[model samples]
Target chain A: MGRIRLTLCVDDSHADDLGDIAGAARRAGMTVEQELSGIGVLTGSIDADNLDALRAIAGVTSVEQERDVTLPPPGSPVQ
Target chain B: MARKSRKRPAKKQAALETLSVSPPEQPQAGGSAPATAPGTTGRFLVLFDRSAAPQAPNTLRRVANLSLASAADFEDGIVEPEGLGGADAVMLPDLAIAIASAPPEQTHALGVASDTGILAIEPERVVYTSGQGWPLNTGPAASADDMAPLDYLRGYRDAVNEVYDRLTGQHDAEAELGAEAVTAFDEADATWGLQATRVVSSQHSGRGIRVAVLDTGVDSGHPDFAGRAVTGASFVQGESVQDGHGHGTHCIGTACGPERPGILPRYGVAHEADIFAGKVLSNRGSGTDGGILAGIQWGVSNKCAIISMSLGAPVQVGQSFSQVYEHAARRALMQGSLIIAAAGNDSRRPARVAPVSHPANCPSVMAVAAIDERFAVARFSNGGLNPQGGQVDIAGPGVDVRSSWPRPTLYNTISGTSMATPHVAGIAALYAQADSTFRGRVLMSMLTQYARRLRAPARDVGAGLVQAL
Candidate 1:
C-alpha cells in the first residue's frame, strides 16, 4: 500500500559499501533501517512501487517484502 | 513466583480419549545426577589476516604475547577482508585488536579491524538449556521421605540401565505397543521404529547439546519431564512460558523426551539434549513473522545447535522464497544453529501436491515432508512445485504420530508436517551428539547424506527419510 519493510540482500563483494548502499536506497525512495554485516543483508522501508528499482541497484542480489508468517493451526485439513 | 502444578478439571475427563502411559509400578526415586560441564573450545573463534599473518609476523607475535592463554591457541586463524578497514588496522599497527569479546563488543572491534585488514572476529555465544525456572504444572511431587538417598541411588541405577537400552535397542517392544498397536504386517510400531529404535538406539542421548524448539508453548506441567531442565521464553504477546496449546509439548516430547517414558510407547528421540523452548506461536497455534524471527534470533544468539519449527503458512504453487527468513536461516547456520521447518500440509489425495510454505521454502531452511509408517509420503505433504527452492528437503514420520499432549489429557495422535519436523530435529540432535563436528550446514548435509531414500519422487521427499547415527 504505502511503505513496507523490505529485506535487501547484497552481493558478497559489495557488502561493505555502506555509502553506496545508502545512496542506492535513498535513490529508490527507501529509508535504510539496519545493515547486517555478517550475512550481507539490509533492512529498510520502501514504497511498493520502488521495489523494482531497488532490485536493479548494483550489487543488490534480491529485494523481498517482509510479511507476517502464521503457522497452520491444529486440526486444519491438509487438502 | 513458585511454579504451581496444573490439574485438568474433572468436567473435561469424559471428553479425553487419547491413550496415556500408566504410571510405572516401579519404586519411587529422586536421585539427581551431577550436571555435566559445558564445552570450552568454541569460546573465541577469532579470524585474522592470513596474508598479513605471514608479512606481519611480528604483529601476530606481539598480539599473541597477550597474557590471555586462549589467544595463543589460535595461531593459524587469519583471513583477508574483502573490503572496509583493511587499510586502517594495517597502517596503524599500534592499535589494540580484541580477539575475543561479547557480541556487541566484537561487532565494534570487527568494524574497526575490517578497515585495517584483520578480516573477521567471531565471539562465543551463550546457549541456554531448559528445566530451569518453569516447574511441572500438574505432576506428582515426592515428599522428603520418598526422596531418600537410597531412592536417589536407585534412580541413578535406573537412568544407567535406560542408557544401556538406548545403546542396545533392547526393550519390551511388543508389550510397550499395548493393544491399540497395529498387529499385522501392515504397520510397524511408530513408537519403536520412527524415532526410537531406528534412530536413538545408534547414538547416546543428546546430552550437553542445546536444542531450541520455536513453536506454540509447551506444557510446563507434563510429568514425564519431572526433574529435566527446560528453559523457555514466550514471544506471543499475552502468553507466558506455559504451553496453553498441546502442539509444542507433543513436538518437544518427540525431540527431547526422556528415555524412560512414564507411559507406554517411548516416542522421544534426543532424550538428554538440553531443551530450549521458545514459544514463537501463541496458545491458539498461530503467530506473526516478527515473533517467529525474534524466536530464531533468540536461538541463534544463544548458540543453540538445532532449532525445530513445526509451523508454516501455505504458499502459492510458484512463489519466490522470503529473503528475510532466508537470511535469518543463513545467519543462524553461520552461528552453528540449523533450522528445520515444516513443508505445508496442503496436498490433495491422488490429484494435487501443494507448494512448500514461506520460510520453509527458503533455500537456507530445511523443509521436512511427512511420511506414514508404510514409508509412503503422506498424501497431505507438500510437493516441490517451484523449480528453485520451495521443495521438501527431507521426510519424517508424521501420519498418526503419538506423542505427549497438555495435561491431564497426557497424550495424543495427530498428523501433519508439524509432527514430521520434530523427527528431523531430534535426529539432527543425535547426529550432533554422535560427532562433535556435526553443527550448522555440516549437520544438515550429514542428515540428508545418511537418509534412507524412499520410492517417492524427489520433489516430495527431497534426499529421503532422515536417518540417525
Candidate 2:
C-alpha cells in the first residue's frame, strides 16, 4: 500500500526518551515529521504495510491515521 | 456532661423583648427593633482573614473593647454557652469567625478597621426549621405560672403562623422578581450569551491568566482589543499569525476580548485575560492533526492555563478517540493546561444527532456543546452517543452569539459548538484567575460542578451550562 500520514502515541515509559522512540520508529520504515515531546506524540508518514512494524516498536503505543479538520466556509451562518 | 442554660444579660434580654414584641407587619428596614432586628440575635458575627485568625482576639479587644473566649481552648472545640461566662465574644479559630455581643457602633468600627483582619461584620440571625417543629432552644425556659395553657397554645399558633407567612412571603417575592426579570436576554448591555452564563455579573476578569486559542489566528488590530496583551504564533507553514479568516478572531473575542468594547453590548468573557493566539488551522480554516499537535505543544510549553480548540473533525458513531490526542491531553493536564474543544456541528437534531468529534472525544479533553438563548440544546449540537470517551463535558450559549470579528466586519453573530467552546474557555480563565491553584483537571471539575443544570438530558448538555465564579 502507498504511504499515509500517521500519529504515533509514545508510551509513558518512553516519554523521557522521545529521541529513542523516534529513532526506533524511523528504523521501522516510518519517516518522522514532528516530535511533540510536550504531549508524547510523534507524527510521520509510513507505508500502510509497515504500520505493524511501527506499532511493534518498544515505546510506541497506538498508531492512528492523521485526520484533517475542515470548518465551513466563512460566509456560512453556522460555523 | 449536662449542659447548663446560660442567663441572658439585662441588655440582651431587653433587646430580645423589643424584637419579639414588634409588630409582624413592621417593615424589615427602619423597624422598631432596628438594633436587634426581627429574626436576629443581638450578637454580631465577624469573619476574619484566615491568616489573621490568631490575632482575632487581640483585634476584637482593641477595636470593640471586648474580651473573647477561644474555641480552641475548649474540649472537642465545642464552645459551650456557659463557658463564655462574662466574655463578650467567642472565637471559633478553625472558621476564623467571632460571635460577639457588641454594640452596633463598635461592630461598625470593627468593619471600618478592615486592615485589622476583619473581613466582614454582620448581625447573627436566628434560623428556624422549615419542618414541623422547632429544633433549637434559643431562650430561657418559661415558668408554668407565666402563662395559662390556652395562652401558651395561642403563642405557639402565632409563632407557626408568623414563620409560615414569612416563608411564603419570601417565596412570593422571589417568584415575582423572577417573573419581572428579563425573560430572554438580548444584546442591550451585554450579549445574550454573557448574560445567560452570568459572565456579566462576574467580578473576576481573568486578570493575569494566559489563555491559548488554537484556531485560525486572531485579528490583533481589532479596536476592541486595543492595549490588550496578545501573543500570536502560526503553526501552519508559510502563514502569518494574522487571521485571514474571521473564525479565530471571533473565537478569541468571545474568550479574551475587552470588558468595554467600542461597540455596544459586551460580548466577550475573561476580559482581562492575556491572549495567546495559536494558528493551528490555516487561513482557509483547515488543519492537520500534526499542526494541531504542534499548537498543543506550544500551549503547554508556554504554561497556558487554558487551551481552546474550536475546530474538530466529525467522528463516526463507533470510532474511538485518538490515543495520540488523548496522551497529549493527559500530558497537558499534568503540565497545568486544560484542553477544551468543540463537540462539532454535524447533528441535524430530532432527525439525526452526531457523536462528539475527534480530539474532543478524548476523555481528558473537555468537549463543549452549544445551547441557544432559550437554554435549549442547539439543533446542530452533537451528543455523547459513543461509549468510553465521547461524552460532552459542558454546554455554553452559542446561537446568535455576538462577538468581535476581523475589522471591516468589526462584529459578527455566529452559531456553532465552535462559538460555544470559547465561552467555556474564557470562563475557565476567570476561574484560573479567581484561584491560582485552579488549573488543569481542577478547573475542568469546577466548570462542570458550578454549571447550571438544564432540564435537558446529560447526553445533550453534559453537566449543564458552564457558569462563572
Candidate 3:
C-alpha cells in the first residue's frame, strides 16, 4: 500500500475549527501526519476510503487526495 | 434500535438460570462434580529468537525473551514433529496446515492431551497435507463432531462448578457486593473462587463504566440490569431490539449480564455502564469495518470506558486491508475508550492462517482468547506472539458457555473468546469498581499479572486463564 496524501483547505474565518475538524477527520479515516503550522494544511491517508465523507464535515471547505491508492481486493492471494 | 429487558441488577441471579435460595423445585439429580483429569502435556517445536545463538530444528522455548527454559514463570512452547503426545504447550507455525497424513489416533491423542496444545502450520501445506487419511473436510466448526463429546463434557463440568459454588456459598465475591462489599469484605474464602461467583466482581465489575456493545442490543428490561443500559441503536437497517443472531445477545448478556443469579458479577464493574448497542452485524453475525469504526466513534463520544468488540476483522495472515482496526482503536483509546476485541476463531489444524487480525492488534486494546472448561486453552483459542507473540491476551471460558439471548431462545451455548471478551471486560469493570481510583491500564495490568497460568499454554492462551477479583 502506497502512502496516499489527503489535503484539506478551510476558510480563514472557520480556521479555529481545524482541531475539532481534524479529530473528526481522524475518526472518519484520515491520519494527521504533518500539519501546516500557520496556514492550516492537514495531511494523512484516507485508509477508510471516506475522503469524500471527510469533506462533508461542517468546517471542511475542500479536500483532495494527493496520490493514487492501490486498494487490494478481498481474498486475493497474499503477496 | 431499542434494547431488550432481560434480568435484574441484583447479584444473586444468573442471566437465565435462577438461584436456588431454597431447595430447587425440580431437585435435579445431584451429580458429583467432574474430576479435573491431568491432560497430555508434551513437546512440540518452539522457535526461539536465538538472537545470539542459533538453535536446532525442533526445540521448545519460553514465551518471554529473558525467560529461559528453567524459569517457572516462563510460558512453555511445544514442538510438533515428535508428536504433541506428552506436550503441555505447542509452538504455533505462522500459518495453519491441514495434516492429511495425521493419523486418526493422533487426532484423538491430541484431543485427549489437554496439556498438549495445537500449533498452527502454514497454509500452503495445509491444502498440501496428504489427503489420504485426515478428516479435514469441515473446519473446526464442523469438527464439532470430533469435539461434541468434549463439549458436552464441558457443559457437565461447568454445571459441576456451579453446583460446587452453590454448596460452598463461599463462591463469587462479586455477588450482591453492596455497601458492605466495598469496605467489609470477608477475608476467609477471599481467594477468587472460580465459577459464577464474583471474587473480583465489584473490584472489577465495570461500574459506572459505559461500554458500547457493538453487537446485538441489550435486554432493555432485564431486571438484573435496571437502567444499566442507557442507549441502544442498530445498523442492520431493519433489525429491531431482538437479538436475531443470538450471538450478540449472548455477548451483551455476558458483557453486562445482571448479577442476580450469583453466577456472574452483580455490581457494575461497569454496572452503571451505558451501552450504545449498534447492531452493525446482522443476525447471521457479519459486518463491515466502516460500521464498526462508526460504532467505535459513537462509543468514544459517549466516553465509554471501553468498547467491547466481539467480532473479528478478517485476515489472510500477512494480507493487509484498508480496514485496519489499529487506527480506529488508537483513535478510540485516544478519546478515552479502551477497545477489547476477539481473536478470530478461524485457525484449524497443521498450519492454518493466523487467527488475529487488525483490531485486537491495534495499540492499547485488549485482544482476548477463548479457554475451555478444562481450563486448558480452548483448542480453537487464537494464538499470539509466538514463539510467544501473536494476538492473544488473557483467556476466559468460551466453550459450552451459557449466557443470555433474545426472548424466545432465552439462553444458549456459545464458543469462541468472542464469547470470552465480555468476561475480561466484565472483570476489568469489576477491577475498576473494587477501587474507583484504579486506572484502566493499571487495572488491566493487575489482572494480567495475576492471571492464573494454565497448564496448556499456547499463543492462543495468552497470559493463561483470567481470574476473578
lDDT of 3 by residue, B287-385 (tens): 654445556666776777667887765455554322234434544554556677776566552245365654565446677877555454555556674
Query: Higher lDDT: candidate 1 or 2?
Result: 2
User: DockQ ranking from best to worst?
Assistant: 2, 1, 3
Report DockQ per prediction, comma-separated. 0.20, 0.81, 0.05
Q: What is the lDDT of residue B107 in candidate 1?
A: 28
Write one digit per residue (lDDT tens) for candidate 1, span B219-251: 877988778889899887888978877889989
> Comparing to the true complex, what docking class would candidate 2 get?
high
For every model in order, the fraction of real contacts preserved is 0.35, 0.89, 0.00
Per-prediction TM-score: 0.59, 0.77, 0.49
Give a tens-digit lDDT track for model 2, residues B1-469: 1222233233433544432423222344433244445455667788999999989988988876777778877788887754464677889988999987655555656766657877877667666554644333333443222234446567598557657867777434222111123387667889989998899999999999999999999899999988999998999999999998999999999999888899888989999999999999989999999999999999999999999999999999999988889999999999999999999999997678899999889999999999887787888899999988799999998889889899889999989999999999999999999998899999999999999977567898899999989
Identify the candidate with maximal lDDT.
2
Top-DockQ candidate index: 2
